[model samples]
Target: MFSSTIQVSVFVFVTALIGFLTYLSCRGQNRSSQNQNREYFLAGGGLAWYFVAGSITLTNLSTDQLVGMNGNQMALLALWEFSAVVGLFVLAKVFLPVYYKFKCTTTTELLEQRYHDKHIRAVISALFFLGSALIFCPAVIYSGSLFMQSMFGVDLPLMYIAVTFVVVGALYAIFGGLRAVAVSDTYSGVLLLTMAVLVVILALQAIDYNFDGIPVERLTLIGDNDSPIPWHTLLTGMIFIQMFYWGTNQVITQRAMAAPSLKEAQKGVFAAAGIRLLIVPAIIVIPGIVSYKLFGDIGDSAYGKIVATVLPDWLSGVFAAAMAAAVLTTFNSNLNSATALYVCDIHESYVNKTPNVPKLSGYVTVLLCLVSLALIPVYQQADSIINLIQQLYGLLSMPILSVFIVGLLFRNVHANAAIGSVLFGVALYSAMSFEFSPMYAPFGLHYIHLMFVTLIACVSFALISNKVIFNQKAEFSLALYKEEEAK
Candidate 1:
């Protein structure tokens, strides 16, 4: 082990560099009312292509994927990243053009415009907020701190570390808004992804360029239905999960919405797809499997323990900064989106029509940080971070994806009919997942395949509801989705 002085010096240097970059990017943005809604919530609608790409990649790249996927301990987990490419392509080619045309502040705004109803917007927005406050934000903090504690061997209490992350991550969200969150994400994303690649290389070296000791199932592409990622589920549910996440989820799509122009945003989305194809697959899988070789079935501790084992003593500090960056990016990104949903969908709609948005956002950010922080202990009980995430969202993701699918595909489906699908979806998926509470997973299908069942049921019921209950109105026309211009 290195001297405490050396560790302190390296850690301080790395964090200071991160601070400098953040200040540099957000220096000129101030808290003016006209600019508040624009700059704070949407980065003044002026984010460039590179920043857009970096923010998008980093927002999703944190411990949720890194620690959680690695915790699964298999190369098959790489398919999650691989499937995301198709999702990004859809976002760029299918969704980006329409979003830019409407100038939406959040993903739900597009839902409202598409259906010509604010209620539809509010429902989806509420789902986004609930998902963030209850599940996404807390899980990020929990999983990230778990990794940090394992890697650094911090002597502090786990709750103390969780609260510390909240304070730091909250500052990034409350002080800067989307501009601050997006810029910091891009700046730190570079260092974080680079260091992750280095870990992959070092992990291979630690194993002496061999995979013989690792289990065959861990290295294989095909997973049984009982595996965390079943191969059959990939053909059915994986694509939709990626689409809902990358294309429609407010936390991620918020970054895409903040771009300067449609062309630039498309470039960013495309660029992120390219990065996922190569870099992300390694970043998520190799280190965990390598840790299997070195440490033997450590579960979630694999990532932190592997990083600690493989990197040089001095580089550990830099890696710490990178991990902190990843943690903060995902945490702050959710906080910003949570604030946006409240202000745009709830507060402005009900509290005050012309409220001081900056002040309101600040208030919302603090409240959300506290709520999310309080939920950290809940996540602490999870068996597998990634599996917990999928299980939690299983109740919402497919159903939400159905809303977009029905709204975008069927022109005659009115706003009221759309709401029925969303409500049904939420209720239906919850019942199916929680059937184990009072029942069992209706006929033994895996949750992933069950997602397909849920989607089809939502769509079919929506169509029937539109025809019988609401009397299909041509309220939203198919022609609204124009061919987005080529870059």
Candidate 2:
């Protein structure tokens, strides 16, 4: 009983310390800028490279990656992290220049500029908002709550813990805006990364660095046909998946875009890529594999259980604090970005153009928080949260990527044609995923491969629809290509 008290004390101390440090870092920023949107949402373009790197890293790192990837208990899951390195590079090299050139406030703003249509921007932003509110927000809360419950062996109801996260995270997004979210992410990231590495080392030690009893498939990086990630799919859909996520996803890209210059943002992204390649992969997968040896097929509980088993009472509290901070930082990051999408993309375009930035964001943040909390029960039934998120994200990801591809690669394409192609891609991927069609079944194609196919179809549909249905000739352009080469 005394041990539990010590653990709780350490957790509170560490969590509060990180918060105080974040407060110190973000204090005295000019909140009353002429462009209030830029000041509030983009941090007035003042974030240095280190904060940009830290925010990008921790915003993506969260308990979802820790709990969900480890839940699989295999080395193959490391491929996700490996591929993400390539994704980050793509963000830095390919996407950042265009974003800088356009001076985009949101990623979808680039689409509006390219296609000359505000409606398409609103449509895509609505999809991003829905994807965040429906999938990411609830999934992060559910997985984080589960990790806490398993780590502390707490008997409290999951919903009770979830509500706590939602409230605290909402406060961060509401009060500090992106500046506080990014600062807190960087601070939490250092603690989380250090403790996660310790957990990995200790986890391996607990098992005496043995893998004799684990199956070959579990230890192998090359996934077979029936595995969750088939080897062939890596060649087909994996690169594009990384491109879409790191290049275009508003939540991740917003950090890079907030930097004062494109070069600074690219530097931050490259640093994040280095971390993904080196540190993230091992920490995410190794502990879970070790847990299988110790606990035997525990699923998502493997990570928290392993941490509790390996660490003593007080250290477990520190790790718990790191994890809870991870949950809050990630939650608020998404809340901030989702509110950015609504305020910049939806509400500003549709409602009052000069609505109060903080006031309107406060209302949207609360609405999103309520919706995310209400959806926690839906994610509770998932067998693997990470895999489930990847699969479900196909409903939006490829279709959205296709729009960017069309907008960036070609000229004279009608905005409605791109929108039509998005709807088509969604329907096609949904039918294939839900087994409404047996077209892919004969070849035993994985859903990842299906995503690639969906992307190609969407791009083709957009181009063809432009010429035939909309009676506008879509011309392939090397203008941006030449401009990028000159740079």
Candidate 3:
């Protein structure tokens, strides 16, 4: 009983310390009234490379990655992290320059500029908002609450813990904006990363570094056809998935875009890429694999159980604090990005040309938080949160990527054509993924491969629909490249 009190005390102390540090770091920076949109959403373009790197890393390195990836309990899942490195590089080298040139506040803003239509931008932004509120936000909350319950052996209802997380995370997004979110993310990231590495070392020690009893498929890097990630699917949809996520997703890209210059943002992205390649893979997968040896097939509960087992009581509190920070950072990052998308892309375009930035964002954040909390029960039924997130994201990921692809790659394409293709891609991927249609089995393709196919189909539909239905010719060329070269 006394040990539990010490653990809770350490958890609260570390959590409060990080929040206080973040408050001090962002104390006077919120005073800018000139271009409140940029100041509030983009941090007035003053974030240094280190904060940018740290925010990008922690924002993506939340409970979803930790609990979900580790839940699989296999080395094969490391491919997700390995592939993400390429995604981050592409974001830095390719997308950053375009965003800088366009001076985009939100990623969808570039679409409006490229297509010369605000409606298409609004459509795409709505999709991003829905994806976050529906899938990413709730999953983070559910998984994080589950982790806390498992780690502390708490008997509290999951909804009670979830509400606490939602309230605290909403406060961060509401009060601090992106600046506080980034600062807190960086601070929490250092603690989380250190603790995660220690957990890895301790887990290995607990198992005496032995791997004799684990199944071969669990230890193998090359996934077979029956595996969650088939080997051939990596060559097809994996790269594009990384591209769409790291390059275009507003929650991740907003950090890079907030930097003062393209070079600074790229530097931050490169640092994040280095971390993903080196540190992220092991910490995410190794603990779960070792837990399998120690506890058998415990599923998503593996990570928290292992942490509780390996760490001393006092240290488990510190780890719990780190995990809580991970949850808050990720949850608030999505909340902040969702607010940015709505205020910049949808609300500003449709309702008011110049709405109150903070006021409007607070309303949006509250609405999103309520919706996310309500959706927590939906994710609770999933077998694997990580895999479910990946599969379910397909409903929007490829379709949205197609819009950016068409908008950037070709000229004279109608905006409605792109919108049409987006709807088409959603319907097609849904029919393929879910059981309402006959496409899933007949294709005999992994979902990853289906993502590549969906992408190609969406792009093709957009171009072809432009020519056939909309009666506009899309002249394909490297116009972005040519323009950059000339500049």
Best by TM-score: 3
Q: Which rank order by lDDT, best down to worst? A: 3, 2, 1
> 1-487, model 1: which lDDT tens digit per residue?
5555576577778877887888898897655666566677888888898988999999999987899898877899998899999999999988888788878888888888778888888888888899998989889988888877877787977778788889988888887788888888988999999999999999999888899888988998888877778888888988898889888998888888888888889999999999999799998999999888878898888888889888988888888888888999899999999889988888777678788887787788788878877888888888888888887897889888888988887676777777788788777777777655543477877888778888888888888888888777434446656554533
Q: Flag regions of model 3 displaced more than 4 Å.
A: 484-487
| Worst ten in a row by lDDT for model 1 | 478-487
What is the lDDT, from 0 to 100, of the residue 229 in candidate 3?
Answer: 91
Candidate 2 weakest lDDT stretch, 10 residues: 478-487
Encode model 3's per-residue lDDT on 292-390: one tens digit a residue.
Answer: 999999889889888988999879999999999999999999999999999999888889988989999999999999998899999999999999999
Per-residue error (Å), model 2, residue 485? 9.6
Model 1 root-mean-square deviation = 1.9
Give lDDT: candidate 2, residue 15: 90
Per residue, candidate 2 scores C-alpha lDDT tens digits across 223-288 of: 999898988888999999999989999999999999999888988999999989999999999999
Clash count (model 2, backbone only): 0
Name model 1 segments beyond 4 Å from true: 30-32, 435-439, 473-478, 483-487
